[model samples]
Target: MKILYKKGIAAVCRIAALYFMAFLIGACPVAAEEEQKTPGIHTWADLQEAINESGPGELITLTGNLTALSSDSGLMIPAGKHLTLDLNGYVLDRNLDSWGEFGSVIQVNAGAVLTVRDSSVSGGTITGGYHNNGGGILNRGTLILESGRITGNTVLHTGGGISNDGTAILLGGSITGNEALLNGGGVCNKPKGHMTICADVVSGNQAPEYDDVFNQGTLTLQEAEPEEFHFEDMTVVRSYMEELAILPFLVMLAILLYVVWIDSYLSRERKRIMLWIVLLVLSLILQNYTEYRMSMQVG
Candidate 1:
């Protein structure tokens, strides 16, 4: 009876060992997958593939600067995907040459969510083409800019930095050194889009119509001071003529100086000299008053 009991115990131990081994073997692949990290993207093709094939809410990290190929239309985040692009202090350039005349640098399609942070979008000098708008980024879905730089992009039509057609939330970022031929050198918010800027993030942009931003849709500046953003159409304290008149004022002052100091007849004419001085003083007063009003409005 003792020998029979020892055999039964040995059989139970063998069965338990087998079950433990099976559990480890079944868990090995999943553990390995969990331990593996996705490689950082280094090339444009690789980046595009990652953007296209990534699952929703996947993170794509850039390992280096990437420039689009000549034949590429552009990188696009497809509809219904949510992706976060960590620029990793690198750049996503559309091109350095004339290839940017074709398509935008990045297009976030409708129903997609893209968050760009910690990098630069400073290439893509776009020119005459069907894709003249949104040289840096064309966002039709939801875009969140947490931090980074959008600079040095040139577009023929509008939105040299970014064109928003859906929703854009700018928490922090610099949109500078971008140029648009017509309007909205930094950003263009379209008629159907909604944009909210919660920080001071735009400056040094160039356009004939609007220097920093053009808002045809809804623009909410949450807690942003009036002096923080320069909008051509929305200056409350000054008109366009008032802004442009500074140079003419300087020119007139120069003429007055020449008449008072250089021209012999005007220099001797006390009444004319007094008249010029009075006019100069009045101009200075007007300029000062305009600036004071602007400051009050800002305050």
Candidate 2:
């Protein structure tokens, strides 16, 4: 009875924590003076107004992607404060009807510190005489991209997918299938910033010259190994090599591991269980540090 009660309380706490996290991902920690723009709820003028009106140590949220094309508008996050720009969802093709030529899906002007996550940018078409610097994302400050897709965009200059001219760090995500008419098809990392593609892909991006794909950037490809895991108290086992989903892998692994470990016909095997446990312990040691390092960098 005591154990059952304890389990019930733990479950309730876990659920409450999850809800709290969902609200706080882009909600609190920012100063009250900072303004928030829920593009889904507010107008472009409202978003820009809040950004300009926000004081230092303040932040502005892009509740969703800003299709502020050629509006000559990308958000500006002031320095000295932690300005987190949560892309909440996808930022699609720019609004060409708004900006004539000098437009970008996103342009973080100089001297700002910004953090973006859990979002994407795609289908950017800049037809006017002006250039589309970054079809997806353009940064001139401190930028961080965590866990999402940045694909299928065309650019004329650096970072056909993304261009960071100041200090930047890309911790984990896909940087592929973007086009550069003149420069880097995937990324043009200038300035003193560094890009570490930890356990990710930098493939399938296009450049005018194949040899001209990468220039003036340092790429450290620290690939992560497949995780060895068993699933959901099931019999199967699954291992993930690249960017595979978690729940599916767990389901498969449970089935496989059960088959290898148990049998109604076979007597209990102490040796086998011990061997597997030792292997698991070693894997935990190796993987913990790698996962920790990937999460710490600012990209």
Winning candidate number (lDDT): 1
Please give the TM-score that candidate 1 achieves against the real structure.
0.62
Locate the minimum summed-lDDT window of 10 residues in model 1: 122-131
Superposed by TM-score, candidate 2 places the C-alpha of residue 198 at a distance from the truth, in angstroms, of 2.2
Q: Give the TM-score of candidate 2.
A: 0.49
The runs of at least 3 residues in candidate 2 whose Cα sits more than 4 Å from the true structure, single-residue gaps closed, are 1-41, 54-66, 69-72, 78-81, 96-100, 119-132, 210-213, 225-299
Query: Per-residue CA lDDT of candidate 2, range 80-198, in tens?
Result: 43454444454434554222344545566677655545433532221211135565567676666554556666666666667766655565556677777777777777655465544
Over 1-299, each residue of candidate 1 has an lDDT whose tens digit, in order, gives 98778667755644553354344334222322332445446688889898988785665667677877677677788998887776756777776444254467788999998877663454212222224777778889998876677777777878888889999887666778888889999889999989987666778999999988999999988666434544322122334444564455445445544434543332357546555654655455455546543432221
Model 2 lDDT, residue 150, Cα: 63
The TM-scores of all predictions, comma-separated, are: 0.62, 0.49
| Residue 220 in model 2: lDDT | 52
RMSD of each: 32.0, 15.8
lDDT of 1: 0.67
